[model samples]
Target: MSTTRSTRPPRTLVHPGPSPLSQRWRAGRVLPLVAGLVALVTACPLLFVALEATQSGWDSAERLLGRPLIVTLLWHTVSLAAVVGLATLVLGFGAAWLIERTDLPAKRTWTVLAAMPLAVPEFVHGYCWVSLFPTVQGFWGAALVMTSSLYPLVFLPVAAVLRRSDASTEEVARSLGHGRAAVLWRVTLPQARPALAGGALLVTLYLLGEYGAFAMLRYTTFATAIYTQFETAFDTASASLLALVLVALALLVLLLEGRTARRGGRVVREGSTARPGRPLPLGGWTRPALAAMAALVGTALGVPVYALGYWLVRGSSTTLPSASIWALTATTLGYALTAAAVATAAAVPVALYAWRRDTRLARALERTAYLTRALPGIAVALAVVFFAIRYAQPLYQQPPLLVVGYAVLFFPLALTAVRSSLAQVPHGVEDVARSLGTAPLSVLRRVTLPLILPGLGAAFAMVALTASTELTATLLLAPTGTDTLATQFWTYTTGLAWGAAAPYAAVMTALSVPAVLLLTRRTLGGTRIPREATR
Candidate 1:
């Protein structure tokens, strides 16, 4: 009995090459460090907010938070966010569906017009409405203006998603005897869930942080309360408490979005060669639908344009000094350009880390970067003021500080655009370059950078436009005697100097036009990253 022959060959203990965990670890070694640094920089204002609140003492904060006014502010803020969010969602979704899924006349033109409201800031919209009708004030007025301004945020993304969605599920539902409306409600809308949620999140965050429009409408929301606390009462403690409450509200919305967003409906076998379904016939409903679109476009776009044109024509004859206008224009352009460049640059590392390295640390950093956008610009400015006064005295009241404030407030805009663009760049290209001995930095510079330039450009334009329109932060952090178009416009508008304010408003709107066109075109043209990368 050859027992030795029955013995199995010695098992070779072949070690695995590299586990997925080790590969991920090696790939992301530098990303976390860079992301952490960027997150810290973005979160600096938030840190200062916490520090300022702490320095004021917990007892003082509790006292401030306990006030009746604080409760009222909370109510107003929450109510406004809810109302505006719903309004924008309905309007955006309806408009997007009509244009994308129905035989809507002038669909291309309608799409562009629908998204143009984003060009007009909420404050500008408020001003136009108030000028036309002085009684437009309080909650309803604020909600109307905000809904109009922010609805475009929802429309753009929703429309883009609708455009790209495979229509197989919708057709299948129709073939199963479901009506067009039923198919839309049960199938199409579900597929657009992610876009709807994203757009709704933006609207909610905008409402939470809104100051100028609410203030102009005489609505006493948390942001307006915080502004008043700082401006009229010179009470930093009360303001910080209010800001903390606002931040909590924003975090609540973010949490809700995170929980719901993951349930987004995705198409099965999206790579299938199924053609998009034809637009459903509007038939008898065409005229009414067209009328509705007309009214929406008129309210959101026409009135503002008419008002600005009317004012510009009326103000052209006024003998106000041209030097101040030119100077303010120059200052606004310079500051906006600087802020856009800096913020876009700062967003690159964060976007790269979040997209390339899908880890908890990377996601946390990305979330931290967006926190500032959820806060009032005044809160961010005050934090910067506190930090500058206490630690970096020399930086206080400097142009650099003002730019830093803009960067903090607008960095998320750049991050969104850059991240979307980065997602489109194929990972295999970078991996192949790496395999061929190209350094990571060189690959980014040579391959990745060129591929994402359009996105970066869009980001720059978006940030620059927003920074130019920024009111509260600019008012707070701007150097003494520094006057941008926004500040000068605010100065005149507050004094009922309509003739004086008109020019600055016109100039500001003019400056925003190019950027707005760039952004609207990019969004409407569907500059989305591949689904695989985003997931």
Candidate 2:
């Protein structure tokens, strides 16, 4: 009775569901808006190129397109892409099969070595090879350098798929009287098709956008043509026109890859259990396989290491001021760090929208973000320069401009990592959190961020590694008198001061090793050991 008389203040009703305003903000507007903004930023360079092309009128376009040189460039570009794509496919698939399926000795060591070339940028590879053999400039040279630099893209994914693949289907095929070769050709390769397609797409894209490597090798692809136009002629119209053609080529590759992937589709294992089977005995093939792998490692990883070492040793007497070296290193690190952080952060919204919304608009935005990457870095940098000079004069030759350019060029790398990480996180968890009256930001902070931390770190490291070695963009965008390691290396190399460039190149390579290790570890993390190894 007394308790009843003591009437406490009426409890305020609280809805368990998220507030209507918050729901509208998160479910309806926020992600799409953020994604759109990111997409718009990424599309700026492409838009500028388009605008410049329009302003130049059809006459300039026709004149440029009518040129015999354009045809030559197109042939060269297509040939290079085809050669590199096929070479990478073969090398990557073969290496993955040997390491994952056979009783290859030092599998772990081989795996790491196989992936090590990823640390060396295509430009660096070109520099190494070209420095050793100055005559190495043209199709053969470009193909050799690009294949060595890019094969890891194929190897990593194929190796991963091979490791995780359930061998039951393969065993069944074998029991059905299929030979090892038949099973491998029909069962194994088909299952690995998705990985192969993805890796091939990446290689093709790299060839399309590649400028530094092609430029160093004196190969005249569309990308190199655009760079030459910008540098020599200062003809924005011509460069933009060429860039549009390059974009078309890239889009063509994207379409082909999409169709191939869809046609191939994934092979669904019947059950959740994945049993790693016994490793295939190499027998008489072991020595030959090992020798083959050794040759691959020698070309991809060994050559670059030896080249750098030789340069460093040869340049020991060269007077590279300690202060200047440290300064350049610091500058390179700072720019790379800034670009990495900005790109990784910028990627989150688009990645999140793509992962969660699954709308046409979201898909378009995500695709648009990737479109810039398909453009050469030279094109991207020039577009940024054009935009900065026209609209944002204050940003001209500024570090911020350089950083933004880096983000545009490398955002795809971060997006790929972030989207993949987001895919692994279940949507139901976020829904549960929202139902429990947690705010969207709170859910992200508590559940999402913690879950995707490893992925974010990997993304950051990858973007940083790429930005540090970026040559054309840095050359165009870096503030006057500012020298990053890449620009400094280019200056010395261009001046035929190979010795002076060596220290910078060596340091760049050294810094890249850690990032490469981080990426390889993340890639290989999903791999399970064969039953034989565990035994």
* Cα TM-score per model: 0.91, 0.92
- Across 349-395, the per-residue lDDT of candidate 2 in tens digits comes to 88888878877888788777767777888888988887898889999
Q: Compare the candidates by TM-score and give the number of the best one.
A: 2
Model 2, C-alpha of 181: deviation from truth (Å): 1.5
Which one wins on lDDT?
2
Q: List the residue pairs that clash in candidate 1.
A: none
lDDT of each: 0.81, 0.83
Write down the worst ten-residue block by lDDT for model 1.
526-535
